[model samples]
Target chain A: MSAPIIGLVDYGAGNAASVRRLISKLGYRSRLVNKHEDFEFVTVLFVPGVGAFPSAMEALTKMNLVKPILDFANSGKPVVGVCLGMQLLADSSEEMGLTKGLGLIPGEVKALSSMEWHIGWNTLDCVGECSIASKSDGQNFYYNHSYEFQAPKEYIVGVVEAENPIVSIVRKHNIFGMQFHPEISQISGFKLMRRLLEEFTDA
Target chain B: MLKKRLTGAVTIRNGMVVQSFGYNRYLPIGKPKVVIENLDRWGIDEIFIQVIDRSAKSLEPDIELIDEIATSGILTPIMYAGGIQNEAQAAQVIRAGAERVCIDTLLHINPDEVEKIAKRLGGQAIVGSLPVGIDNNGIIYWYNYQTKEKRLLNDRLLSLVKDGLISEILLIDWQNEGFDEAFDFRILELFEKYNLPLILFGGLTSEKTLKKAFDAPMVVAAAIGNRLNYSEHAVQTLKNQLTSAPIRTAYYHDRSIFKHYD
Candidate 1:
């Protein structure tokens, strides 16, 4: 079977280049989805983000991508959000004052109470049988964030301890959110990405 | 648990990889891309790249070099330092694919700019690079290489931490950098007051010294530059020896997909 085309959503938040490079390294083709029409034939959608939460939401709204993203998530396609992208999947965020998120996942993004930011390599404790989390069980993935996803226990697939047990990966049916940057998490990260991509393609 | 990081630093001077000693003497190594690629293949937790000469020559962060490294398709997270003086440069470096930007001279020159950078790029993306020197009496001072100035390390840094200007601190031993001496434990003792996540560097040439630095509860990562230039798979070897520590072991294998790219 041929590799699936991964649509990497670019909403002006940084981190697209690194994710694109990593996808290409996996022997798959990924295109930047800047407009709604770009997602027409894409098998899986990847929302890769870095930077502030408010600005990311503003970019998505300004680009007329908010509705398209929601429609795609509702359409039962595999949607993966990374880092700030993952935070944007929540109902709301406390960063820069209660910014509304995409609300696809049942959660809220809150700032970590730790004095030190969660900025390093951290391992994920798998809590479910989600393909990505199961493969990445007890494996270290690179993380650089100040806010974390606070969701119901059933929606959480993986977690990491940083001051408290914070949600690191959440899976709700076809929609998946990873708090860490799998693109830069070295071999294990690539394996997780490949597994997620394979799940979508095989589905 | 948050794994303690083993970062491989690649110091570049005038676009060529160099081994820096005391931040003054430099020995030329090979190309930086080659070194970075090897580090990525060895499964390093993170990569720190610093262009040592950019600030001395009053040049900007080498955008071309950054673009080259970013497009090289290395998968390890990269933290870039040197010549990042403003918020625009910090944004540019992140856009070029660096995960974090380290600021040294700016911490002493204009700390407000550092705060502005943290606000712009988020605190996690900003790192305070404090190159410190110790006197015989065990007093710690910020060592400025360009001005040869020494300012007493004090509450000013704590203010930065309080204001969320920097998420992590890259503590460098100015007096013992690039040398085979042991890391000054007194500096670690002094920094423990702040309780910030520390990335300790300088004079850490062996596992013994690295373990000593890692033993400190505040230290979250340890970086090595000059010594890594001499050998291949240096990071992997070091990670193997320090397995009991919080450092992540290399998970790359023959069946890994990255081997296909290699």
Candidate 2:
């Protein structure tokens, strides 16, 4: 049997390397797919980000990866969006103006409009069923962002707060998104990533 | 009511995690993954993986070990240091799963390298690791391990800060390792003039010292490699003590939020 290949979208964001490191740490080979051609070999797709939403989305689209990425997500393969990447899944973002996203999840990315960057370590409030987030609440995950998903209640699988309420994790069947950096969050982060790998790969 | 954060340290040697202090006194700590996982389980906020081995000869970061720690499922952020002489290595460490990179010898070798890494990776990810030595006359000198040179600590710190090369500074007391003495607060007083976050290391023996350091406005966090490794349940006990404070009530409630994500 061959090891599952996880594709991390490299849209020139700062965290692609960290995400790749996390994926490699999980005993899997992760490729940094910045070009659209690499999409064919990806068993699972991970769109990871750590900076501004509009710029990230623009860069992804500019790289001409939006269609192939959305196609991959719709193909029923496990697709994940982390932090800024999660914010990129929403239909629209009020981050800079009214920037568009992949619209894979029913929501919008808005400035924490109310909360500060919610930096440092905080626990997750897992609410619904998820292959990665299930049975894992009260687990601290690192968050460093000034924006979050205004995701619908139905898709919100987890949450973390600081100064104001914000969504921490979300999903829609095979599609998943996390507002925290599980890579840096330590064990909890690793557990979530591992669960995702197992669920997606069924290993 | 502000609640402070818990910090942990991992000393790496020759790409392997080693326990050492007081200058050249080394002990094998096995794997960095196990050490990091142990600290992560204890609920540390941030971890510092100091690469003492990288400083021995050529400055090359141990990227593989850093990647290993990232994959181990530890829940703390890691700050990797040692052998980071330039921007490429610093970026590699960040790409290898280090949340921050600390530069010591490079601050003296190529001051521009420090600023370059900070500018690219963000200042928060770049830290200055200064080894302070108290000579026979009680005069403190900053030792550059790469160049094997010692200069007055203040001058070195001022020069680094002036160049915008360092946003955070880790002050290590080289002579007091395992001596059970407290950090040299008098030496750190000089850092107060600069607007940098000072992290004190070397002789952090007890919670009392931690409390003292916490009270100081200049000190953001304290590093205790010897005391933590020596004391049983020291990590858990300290965290329990910290989380037990009234200030952490709301933060504890925040932990409840993990349920939604689970």
**Top-TM-score structure, candidate number:** 1
> Model 2, range B94-206, lDDT digits (tens) per residue?
77677778888777777767767765654546678888876678777888765668887556557665554455678887766545765666667655666566778877766
Error of 2 at B100 (Å): 2.2
What is the TM-score of each candidate's chain B when compared with the real chain B? 0.95, 0.84
**lDDT of candidate model 1 versus the reference:** 0.85
Per-residue alpha-carbon lDDT of candidate 1 for residues B107-199, written as tens digits (9 for 90 to 100)? 878888888888778888888888987777878888887899888876777788767778888999877888895578889998787788889
Model 2 chain B weakest lDDT span, ten residues long: B244-253
Residue A30, candidate 1: how far off, in angstroms?
1.7
lDDT of each: 0.85, 0.72
Provide the TM-score, chain A, model 1: 0.96
Using all chains and alpha carbons, the TM-scores for the candidates as numbered come to 0.95, 0.71
